[model samples]
Target: MSYISGARKVRVMARYDVIVVGAGIIGAAVSYYSAKKGLKVALVDKKYPASGASGACNGGLSYFGKSGKLLQDAYDSLILYRELAKELDYPIEICQDELFVQLATTEEEIAELEKNVEECKRFGLDAEMVSKSTLHSLIPGLSNKPIGGAIAQGGLHGFVNPFTVIYGYLDKVKKLEGTIIPNWEVVGILTSGRKVKGVVNKKEEALYAPVVVISSGFETAYLLQSLNLTLNIMPNRGVVLVTEKAPWKLKKKLMGANFGSTGQNVSLCIEQTLEGNLLIGSSQEIGVLIREPNIDLIARIANNALSFYPSLGKVNIIRAFTGVRPHREEGPFLGEIKEYEGLFVASGHGGMGITLAPWTGRTVALMIAS
Candidate 1:
C-alpha cells in the first residue's frame, strides 16, 4: 500500500530502503535521522513509543561518576544532545547537576574520595573536598556519615519528558516522509541467504525492507534470535519514585554510591523535573526481573532521598515504577553486528539510554547514510 507521506508505497513484494524495528528511544533516533536523510524508512513498534525503558528513565545527561573512556563517550554524546535540543527545539532542560559521591563514613572511603577527587580534576573537572558545614550549605539534609567528596562544575544534564523526546522525533519523521506503524508487532523476519528482506507484522502484514536496525531493549534479543541472531542482552530493572510538588530542597541533581535498600553500588539520585515533581530513583537489580514495585525498595528510596533532604519527608509519593536497561556480555553493542550484513544494533545502554539516545540516533543515521 502506498502512503502519501512518502513518494513510494510500502511494497509487500519489494524491499524498502530501511526498516527500524522497536520504536524506543534508539529506534526513534535512528528513524529521525534516517527520514531526515530522505530515506524511505518505517519505524515499527509493537506497543507505543517510549512505552519501555525510554519512558521510565530519569533524563540525566551526566559527566560525573564515569571515569575513563566511558566518561569521554558521555562527553561526546552530551555534545550531540546539545545540538539536537537546539535543532529539534524540544523542551530539553539543561541543568548543572552536582554529583556528591558520598563517602562510607570510614577512613578507607575518605581516602578513596580524596583519590577520586584528584582523578576527576585531571579531566579538567572539579572535585573538591567539602566539609560537613560546606556540604550543608549545598544540601542541608545530607547524611552526616562521610566527610567529603568530588564536585564537577558545569555538569550539564538535559531533562525532558522521555515520551516527548520520542514523539517529537516521530513527528519530525512523519514530516520528513517516514512511515510509522504503531502496534505493529514484528512477528517474523524474512531473510534470503545472508541479506535481510523484511518482517511479518502482528497483523500478518508482510513488510519488506533491505536494512533493519534493532533498537529494542531487553525484548530485542528474542526478536533477533527468531531471525537466527543471538544478542547477549540482559534485562536490568531500575525503580523510581515521584513525590507531589514540593519546594526545591535540591538545587541540583543528587547521586550517591548505592541504593539505600539494596546497597547494590548503583546510583540513587533525585532531581526536580520541569514539572514540580521530584523524581527519586533508582535501584539497579541484575537479570530479568519483576514489574511490581517493591514497597520495601520504595521505602529505601524515600529514606535515601530524605538523607539528602530531610524536608523531603513531608512530600507524598505519587507513584513508583520500573524501567529496564539492556546490558550485554561484551559491553554496549553499537555500530554493526558482524553476524548480519543489513542488520545493525543500538541497544544495551543499561540506564544510560537517555544520556546516549541523541548521539546514538545520529550515529545510526550516519551509518545508514554512508
Candidate 2:
C-alpha cells in the first residue's frame, strides 16, 4: 500500500505486516515466530543468515558460564528449546550430560566453589560438592591439582549449528508464506510523521511494513542512530579452536572459570562433534581487532584445554576462529524502541543469543501481535 521511493512511476509493493532486519539468530527467530502467528512477515538482511556472531559462536548452552541474570534466562531458554525442538522436529543436539568442574587451585578458590554450589542449589539447580578423587573418576584425564570442586547436575548443553537453525527457521517462515530478502541492507528507516512506515534498502528501494524489528547484533547501534534512536551495544570477541579427530572418551562437558592452572579468567569447555573433531574455546576480548584469527590467543585456548584434559594435547589443531558477541549496554535489549513508533529491537544478547533466540522470538511475536 506504500510507494517505493526512487522509482520511475512510484511502484507499490504489497505492504507487509512486520519487517525484521538482520538475519542473525535473533532476527530469524522473530520472523519465524511472527510468521507462524499468520502475520505477513518479511526478513531482510544485508548479508546471509548466520554470517555474524551466530556463525562465529561456539554451540554451548552452559548455565555455569552465565551470570545471575543470564542464568535465569538460560533456565527459561532451555524449556523453550525443548518446545522448539518438538515443534520444529529438527536434529537439535541437546543433551543433559553437562557438568561444571571447579579446579580449586587455592583455599579461596575452594570456598568460591562452595559458594557457587550453594548459589546453584538456591536457584533450584541440582548441584553436588565433589572431591578431587570424584572429579578424576568422572573425567579421568582431568588435572589433579585441586583439593575439590563442585558439580552441577541436570545441566543441559546443546550444539545447534547456527546454519542449521537459520535454514530450519527459514523453512518454517517460507511455509508460512513469509518473504526473506538477502543483500538488502537497510539504508534508512522511513517514518510517517512520528510513526514508522517502512525502510529503504541499500539500492534505494523502499519496502513498506507496519512493524519493523531491528536484530542487527552489534551493528544495531549504527543503524538506529541513523534514525535518531539511541542504542548501546558492544562487541566482545571470543576465540575458538578446533582440534583434529581423536579417540573420544570424554562423556561429560566441563566448565571452569579457571581455564588453566594459572587461575586466569577463562572458560574451558569441550564438545566432540559427530565427526569426531573436538571443539574447545575460551577468552573474551572486547573491542579488539576482529579481522583475522589470533593465533597466539587461540593457542592459549588450546593450551588451556590441554591443561585440563591432557588427552587433548596430542590432538592437532585444525582450525581457529573468532566470534563477536553483541553485548548490550546493560542487560538485554528487547521490546519496542521508545524513540520511534513501530520500530522494535531485540539485539544485545551478549553471548547467549542461541540459547535465548527461541524465547525472544516468541516474545517479539507477542509484542508485534499486541
Candidate with the greatest TM-score versus the true structure? 2
lDDT of 2 at 112: 73
Which prediction has the highest lDDT against the true structure?
2
Local distance difference test values of all predictions, in order: 0.72, 0.75
Give the alpha carbon lDDT tens digit for every residue of 1-370 in model 1: 5322122233363356889988888899889988888899998889988888888888776755556766666667776765666677665455535453443345665666666666667776656766666666776666675465445555554455677778878988888888888888887776666776677765446678778888888888888788677768888888889889886645566666432323263455777777678888878776846888778888887886676567778789999888887866555677766766778888887767777777788788898889
Which residue pairs show collisions in model 2? none
Alpha-carbon RMSD to native, per candidate: 4.6, 3.3
Number of colliding residue pairs in each model: 1, 0
Q: Write the per-residue lDDT of candidate 2 for residues 21-136, one digit (tens) a residue.
A: 99998999999999989999999899888888888877666565344766777777767776665677666555545554556666887777777667767788766678888888
Residue 138 of model 2, lDDT score = 82
| Candidate 1: 10-residue stretch with minimal lDDT | 2-11
